[model samples]
Target: MAILDIFVNFIQVSMPRSNVIILTDPASQFSMEKSSTTVLPIQGDYSRGNLMLQRIMSYITFLEQRLKEHPERLKCINHYIFTDSDIALVGNLGQIFEKYHDFHLALTFRNNKDQPLNSGFIAVRGTSDGILRAKAFLQEVLEVYSTKYMKASRMLGDQLALAWVVKSHLTFATKKFSRPEAFSGDINGKLVLFLPCLIYNWTPPEGAGQFHGMPLDVQVVHFKGSRKRLMLESWNLFNSTSNLSDMLCLILGSGRTKYDF
Candidate 1:
């Protein structure tokens, strides 16, 4: 429930108007009376194989239901930030939309040569045009997956397919050369802004030489593996102090002492 804590105490505390919509499975769903949160459980006992595809389908289903139930409410929202639960919010997200308002969608990309574009954190505009672009993009990814995606494992069929789509379709004009930089591209004519993974969907390895405990510039931190413990550590120490720099002691005490950055 770290996300719930981060939302209620931190995120909602600042942006009280924002709503948290969680699409989870029935077994893991939390039944709570959160005024600004809506938890909708997907109807299925989906196997571990290809859960990402199921989630994309579930998202489409949820949007269709919302369109039928509250079309007016949908019109009021200008954008939506799609991210995984494992990530923690430490920095201001308002800067992304404010700065990259021209693009219809924004996606984070890893620095790796294989599967560079990570789909964990996506910022999509909620306008009609943006919605159409998102729909088209997902449809294209699904199409590509059906025809070309050879999964390394059953899970994350969507991510791998997404990588193919980005490489083949989301082409930029000039070469991008920088870390933590934001650049724009087009996917079948739909504009998509690519933000560096170091700043957006960052993993522990990204901050190997730097201070990793919620840096002032990072907006989200994606704990991909055992690094998830860092989230727990941060939450445990969350109420103790207001200064984020103090988190270094916990990191150092945990047997990691390379703090040259």
Candidate 2:
């Protein structure tokens, strides 16, 4: 099997029992039988911008409708949103959620960009207030997507929408936990917390040879931009040798010997 195939298999085998939902094209070959995981197949010829916008809209809409149909099911559950391409390298996500129990939404910053937040990976609490804020956030994004003025700007779709929300509504606050910075604000008289980027959604620097080490507590590694290949190669090497240091060396393209381990 190919290296990426091996990496994908490892992720499937090791994924936690949390509610993992994936949004992808219907024809994708990725499959999982976990009872806690749900794969929502998307069908459309949308542009990259439109596809992300629709994915967020669809997921929020599904959550809203499900809660409406069964209010009791909303008890004691948290909703996590991730793009299909993201990977969980290490850490139990349930623990991460527990650590940030007070936060309503958790998101990370984009690497090598001026954008303060990335919509690819997010965590949302299950409270009624959290759900309402998420719905409002999605609605604001939809409006931006629908408008020609904002859509014509450099950032479109989810990123632009999230940027707008952070600028206008979300307020930054310092938390005493591992990730000190968080965004907190009120929505319709309810307090909502948006956790810092380093807590949940961490991305490696962009570029082939730029290999600054990841934070020790990064829960999710978003292989955004052109670094997917590097991440796959590192994963393949790590699986074979089980040496994280070597994997880091390979990912960074440092002069360290790949066979040293």
Among the numbered candidates, top TM-score falls to 1
Global lDDT scores for all candidate models: 0.66, 0.56
Clashes found in each candidate (C-alpha, N, C closer than 3 A): 1, 0
Q: What is residue 9's positional error in candidate 2, in angstroms?
A: 5.0
lDDT, model 1: 0.66
- Which parts of model 2 are misplaced by more than 4 Å? 1-15, 25-37, 42-49, 76-78, 110-114, 148-155, 170-180, 187-192, 206-211, 242-249, 252-261
lDDT of 2 at 46: 45
Query: Compared with the true structure, what per-residue lDDT tens digits does model 1 show for residues 160-242?
Result: 77777887764442245235577887877788888887777766543446444533466666756566566567656865786
TM-score of each: 0.81, 0.72
lDDT of 2 at 3: 34
Per-residue lDDT for 31 in model 2? 68
TM-score of predicted structure 1: 0.81
Off by over 4 Å in 1: 1-10, 13-16, 27-29, 66-71, 171-179, 206-216, 248-261
Q: Which RMSD does model 1 reach against the true structure?
A: 4.2
